[model samples]
Target: MMSTAHMASDSILAAATASMSIHSTSPNTTNSTESSISTPERPSGIDNCLIETASGRPVVPRRIVNPIAVAPMVDVTTSHFLHLCKIISPNYTLYTEMIHCNALVYHPDDLYNFFGEPWEGKVVQLGGSDPEAMAKAAKLVQDNGYKEVNVNVGCPSPRVQKGAFGAVLMKTPSSVVDIIQEMVKVGVIIPITVKCRIGVDNLDSYEYLYDFIKLVSTTTPVTHFVVHARKCWLKGLSPKQNRSVPPLKYEVVHLLAKDFPHLTITINGGFNTNEQIKEQLELVDGIMIGREVMDNPMFLAKVDAGYYNIPAEKIKSTEEVIEEFLEYVLTEHERGTPNSNAVVMAPLKMLYGGRRGKEYRRRLARAISPRTKSLPDIVRDVRLMMQEMDYGGVTTASEAEDNGGSESDSDSDLDAASHSASGCV
Candidate 1:
C-alpha cells in the first residue's frame, strides 16, 4: 500500500511498504510508524505444529518464528557455520551440510563433532540411499538431539551422483519411502523431511512428480517438503551450474502444494529479494533462502518481531553485526582456538555482503590468499588494512601487532616444548 510519495523515497521505504503488505490489513494499521504483519492463529494441539504431507507422514515443524532458513551449502553448513548463524539470528532453522549416512553412523565420533549445539533447534540434512544406513543415522541424530532430520534429494554434484544419492534419489520414490519409514521405525521422534527438486532433466512431468509425492507420503506422511522449484540437469551440469541453469518453475511447486493440501511446502530457488521472500511467505508455509540469506544475513532477524509478533531486536546493520562478531571472535580467540581457521575466517567473511561491503571483500580476499602471505600474517595485515579503510571504527596497527605477538609467542612455546620433549626421549 505504498502511495506515490512513499514509493519515491528509498529502498527501506519500499521494503516497509512490502512488509506491511503481508498482513494486508487496512492502511491505517501502523504502530509507531512500523507496519505489522499478522500471524496465523495458533493451532490447538501439537498436530497444528506438525507439517503433514499429502502422503500422511508427519514432521513437527519446530515452531519457526521466522520463515527464513539458511539453505544447506556443502562444506559451508558445518557445526561452526551453524553456530555463527545463531549468533546473528536465532530465528532461522539452520540446516547442516548433507551428512553421508554411512559416515555418520559408522564414525559416531565424527558425527558427534559435526552436530554442534547451535543445532539444538535446527535440522540435519542426510545424504544416502540405504534404508538401514539412513535409519541408523536418523536414530543416532535423534539420540544426539537434532530437532529434525532431512533427506537431501536435490544436490546435483558429480561426487554425490557417483554414490547414487542426492538429486538422483528423486528418480527413485520407493527408495525414499523406505529410508523415511526406516528412520521412523527406529524411533526418530522428530519429523523427518525431504529437500527435493521439481523433477529430473527430461522427466519433468506432473505425473512423475505426483507419483514421487504419493510414494513418499504413503510410506512416510511427513509433510515438510522444501522444494527447490527447478529440474536439475544431472548429466552435464556442474553442481553450481545445476543450481543456476535449472529455470525456476515455481508454478510446478505451487501446483503440487495445491493438490496436496495436507503438506507444508516451502518454495526455494532464485528468490533473492525481500519482496520475493515476503511474496513467497504468503504462498508457502515457509521459505528456504540460499544465496540471499548469505548476502543479507540480517534478513531473518526481524521475523520474530515483525511477522510472528515475538520480541526480537530490530535487524542490526551489517556494520553493527560485524562489530559484535569481531568482539566475540576476538574474545573466543583469547580464550582458546586462537589459530582455528573456522573461528577466525568465518565472521570476517560474513561481513563482506550487503551494502558498502565490496572494498572490504576485495581487501580481505587478497589478504587471505597464499600468494600474499601466511595465514597469521594475513590476519594481522588485514586487520590493519581494515583499520586503514576506517571500517565503522578504526582499529590500530598496535592492537593487530599485539595480537600477532601473542599468537607467535604461543606457537613458539609449543614448538620449543615439543623439541625439548623429543630430545629428552
Candidate 2:
C-alpha cells in the first residue's frame, strides 16, 4: 500500500526517467543494462522517528547526534548486530551491511527480514552503479523506513570487483554521481551518503581522494562522506589482506576535514579504543568503528555518556546487555525461522571477545548444532559462565573450529546470497 505522497513521487520518477542517460559500462561491469526500474510499494507508517523541519514538514533524521557510525561490514553488520549496538549505545548511528541495489529492486518480497523494519534511526547502504536501479533502491529503502541511504565504494572483495562496483567505483566517480543524482531526483525523502576509501589501486594519492570528494560532493546533494583511511587493491589482494595490508594514512582524511569544513567527514580504519576515537574526533567530524566494535560490542556501551553527554546511569552493564540480546534470540526463535539460532548466535558469540572469553566462546560453539541448543540452555549457560566471572571467546569447541575460519571455511555468504537478486557486496 503506497502512501499518497509516495505514489505522487513514483509518478514523477517514471515520467522524468526518460531523460536520464546510461553511459557505457566502466570496464569492470561484466554486463550493463539500461532497463527502466520500477519501485515496489512497501507498507507505510514507517516514519516513526522522522523529525520535523522548520516548515513543519516531516523529514528523516539526518543529523546523527554524535555522528559516530558503526561501519557496514558485510556478514557482520546485520540488522541484528546493529540492533545490538543500538541497545548498547542509543546515540551512535548504525548501518546495515551493503546489499546490492538489485536485491531491493528485484527480489523485494524475499527480503522481509533483510534490513528489518528499523523503528530507530538507521542507515542502509547499497552496492551498484546503475543510476535508475540506485534510485529505485533508494526509494525502497525509504519506503521500508531506513533513515538514510548510503552508497558503498570501499569494498575490495573479488566478488564486488567482478560486479563493477565497490572499491572499483572509486575509478568511476561519474557513475556514482549519476546513481546519487537519480536517487535524489526520484524523491527519496531520506538523506543519501557515500562510504568510500581514501584511494584505490594506482590512484593512491591524496590529491586523487581530494579531487574525488570535490567532484562527488560538488555535484550531488550528498553532504556526508565516510572515508576509510586505507587504500584498497582491486587486484591480487584478498579482501582480508586489503583491510590489513594497506597502511591507513589517516592524515589524508584529516586533511580532507581541514579542507572541506562543511561536509560531515567520518574517519574509519584501525581505531580500537575510546581513547583513539576521542583523539580522532578532535580532528574529524566522526569516527567509524569496525571489526574492533564487532569483536567486542561492549566497546560502545559508554558512547552515550562519553560522546553524546548522556548521563552514565542510563548505561547498562555487559551482563545485562548480553542477557537482553539472548532474550532477543529467544523471541526471534519463537517465530519459527529455521536459521534463527544460527543468525542470532553469529553476533552473540562475538559478545565475549578476547583471551579471557575463550572458554565461554568454546561453550557457545558446542551449544549450536545442525539443529541447535534450546534457547533456555543458551541463556542458562551464559548466566552460569558470567556468574563465575568468565566471558571467554575465540577458542572454540575443539580449540580449532570457530576460530573465525582457522579450522573451517567462513562461507556464510551462500545463505545471504541466495536471497540476493544480483549479489551481496
Candidate 3:
C-alpha cells in the first residue's frame, strides 16, 4: 500500500497537472512568454499596486523584477555578503540572515553591525513566533529601508526550535497567520513573505502542506512564499544533516504553484545551475539559490548577463568588481567602522578562484595577516602581490593609469587611500 503522504502527494499532483493542462491550452496563456507566468485573479486592492504614504510621498514600490533571489542562510548571508552578491548580479533579490525579533526590539544599538551599507532590493528575514514582536521588528526593518520582510519557518536548527520558532512553526499555521497579520496591521507597505519546508516531522503530507499555505494566504495579505522543497526531521538529525538528509521533492513545490496560481511561489533547495533555474522558472515564479552561490560567489556573475539578459557592457569584469568592493571596504574602515576580515577577504576569495587560485590565495592570506596593522597596508600588499602574479591580468590602481588604464581608476585608489588615512584617527 502506498503511504498516506505519497498518496496525498500523488492526488495533488494529478489535480495540479490537470489544471496546468487547461491553462496551457488557453490561447492567452499559450502565447505568453515563460518569464511571464500567469497569476490567478486577485482582488483589485491586492495587486501590489502603488500606495502612498500619509505624508503624500510615493512609497518605493515592492516589485521583484527578475524573480531570482538569494536564500537566507544562517551565518552566510550577512549585509556585506548581500552587497557583494548585488555587485555581481544587479537584478536578483538578496536576503539578510535570519534575525531574531527580540534583537531588533531590545538591542537597537547593535543593529548597524547586522546591517552594513544600505542597498536597494534587499529583504530582511525575521525569526520569531510572537506576533507583537514580529510587528515591531517589521517596522524597524521598514525604517531601515528593507523592501521586503520574510518570515523564516524553514530552519530546523535545534536552537531555533527551542525558541518556539523556525520550522517548528510549520506545524502551527494559525500562529504564522497571526504573526503575518500583525506585520500587515502595523503598516508595513512592502510585501511580506514566508520561507518554509514542504513539511515538518510527522506533518509530512501533501494535504498538510496545502492546508498550511491555503490558510495563510486566505487569512493574511501575504501572497508570496519561498518553499524549501523538503521536509525537516526536527529530531535525530543535526541542522546540517536536516539540509541534506531530507529527500528533495521539487515536484510538490511545482504542483503547489500550479494549484495556487495567484501566489508568487519561489522554490529553494538543490538548484546549482542555470539550466535547473530555467526549468524551475517554467513551473514557478522565482528561484532561490543558497549554499552553492555562497561557496562560489562568482556563480552570480553570470546571473545578470545570462538569466536577466542584462547587456554585457553593464556587467563589471571580475577585476573591476573586486576593486569596487575594496573601495566600499576602505570607506567603511575610514568611518571608524571596525574592519571585518571576512568582509575584506570575501571578494578576494571569489576573485582568486581562477587560474593561479591556490598561489594567489596563499600569498593574499599572508598579506592580510593580523600583523598587517592597518586596512591600507593590507590593500597595498594584496595589490602588489596580485600585480606580481598577473592575477586576472589586473594592474594595481596606480599601475593601471601608468600603463594607460583609465585616469578615473587611479583617482579612485588615491581617494580610497586618503579616506583610509583619515579613518585611522
Candidate 3 lDDT tens digits, 1-425: 11433444445445443442122221122222221122322222222333534422234333347678887876567666777777666777888788999999997656567766556668888999999999999888887776788999888887888999999898777778778878877888888999998877756666567767876777777899999976676676677666666667887887677566667888998887778877777677888988666555666656555566666666666567666777766776786655456444544553444335555555756666664357777777777876787646332221211121111222222212211110000
Q: Who wins the TM-score comparison?
A: 3
Each model's lDDT: 0.60, 0.65, 0.66
* TM, every model: 0.68, 0.73, 0.75
For this target, which candidate reaches the highest lDDT against the unseen true structure? 3
Give the lDDT of residue 357 in candidate 2: 51
Instruction: Estimate the overall C-alpha local distance difference test score of candidate 1.
Output: 0.60
Q: Tell me the tens digit of each residue's lDDT in model 1 across 1-425.
A: 12321222333223323432232223221222322222212212213334555533343443345567778876556565566667666677788777799988788756545656535558888889898999999888887777788899888777788888888887666567767877877788888888988766654555556556655664575777888886666675666556555556776776666555577787888765556666666556678876544444444544434444544334454445555655555554554542344334543554443233555655655555544344456556666766687756322211211111111112222222211110000
Better of 1 and 2 by lDDT: 2
Model 2: what TM-score? 0.73
Which runs in model 2 stand beyond 4 Å of their true positions? 1-63, 110-112, 302-313, 336-340, 354-356, 370-425
Model 1 weakest lDDT span, ten residues long: 416-425
Number of clashes in every candidate structure? Answer: 7, 6, 0
lDDT of 2 at 71: 78
Candidate order by TM-score, decreasing, is 3, 2, 1
Evaluate residue 310 in candidate 3 and report its C-alpha lDDT on the 0 to 100 scale.
61
Candidate 3: segments with Cα more than 4 A from true spot:
1-63, 309-313, 393-425
Per-residue lDDT tens digits for candidate 2, residues 245-322, read 666677778767656666788899888655777777767777888776665666675455555555555666565676
